[model samples]
Target: MKHPVTPDGRYFAVRCRLWRMVNPDLDEAERSKLTKRLMVARRAVRDAKAARDPEAEAVAHRAVDVAKRALGERGPVWWKDGSPDLNRRIAKNTPYADWYAQVTRSRHGGS
Candidate 1:
C-alpha cells in the first residue's frame, strides 16, 4: 500500500518514525543501505508531487513494496501496535525529539 502523505505535501510523520526504529541495531553498512532506500523513496515521492509522473509513482510504490516484503521476511519483531512503543522511545531521546519537532514545526508552521 502507498504510504499516506500529508495534505500540505509532506510525507506522513509516521514513515520517518518507523524508519528510525530500524536504525539502532544496524551496522554502518546496514544504516547506509537503509538510508539509500529511504532517499530513493523520498525522491520518488517528491517527483510524483512535482509532475504527477507515473514513473515516480511507481518508484514510491516499489519502495513500500520492498519494505513490507523485508519486514515479512524478518518475521514480527513487535506487535502491530508498536507505534506506542516507538513514540515513547522517541520521546525519551533528545535527538529524536529535536528532529521530530523540527519536521513537525516545518510542516504545520508552528500550529
Candidate 2:
C-alpha cells in the first residue's frame, strides 16, 4: 500500500513519522538507476549480516548511503524552500502537524 505524502511533496508518512522523499527533479532514468543501486546495496547488507561479516556489512552500509544520497533520499534536503529537513521526525510534532492530523482524521472517518 502507498504511504501518505505531505502536501508539499517532500516527504511521506509511515506510522505517523516523516521520511524524506526522493528528489522529484531527477530524470526518470537516473532515478531508476540509483534505485536499482540502492536495492543491490540493501541486499548486500542483508547477505553480509547473515554471513556475520562485519567488514562486508560496513561496506554494504556505505554503499546504501551512497545510493540514497544520490537519489536525494539522504544527506541534504531535496527541497529548496528553506524548510528544515524533517526526515524521521514525528509528523504531529512538526509544522506538518495540522495537515497530518487532518489526513489521519479523514482516513479514520473523522474520528
Most lDDT-accurate candidate:
2
Clash pairs of candidate 1?
none
Worst 10 residues of 1 by lDDT: 3-12
* lDDT (CA) per prediction: 0.51, 0.94
Residue 48 lDDT in candidate 1: 90
Runs of candidate 1 with Cα error greater than 4 angstroms are 1-20, 64-75, 78-111
Candidate 2, 1-111: lDDT as tens digits: 288899899999999999989999999999999999999999999999999999999999999999999999899888878889989999999999999999899888996
Q: How many backbone clashes does candidate 1 have?
A: 0
**TM-score, cand. 2:** 0.95
Q: Write the per-residue lDDT of candidate 1 for residues 12-93, one digit (tens) a residue.
A: 2463542323423447786667667767776777789788888878879788557633433223443353532332233325
Best by TM-score: 2
TM-score of each: 0.40, 0.95
Cα displacement (angstroms), candidate 1, residue 59, comes to 3.6
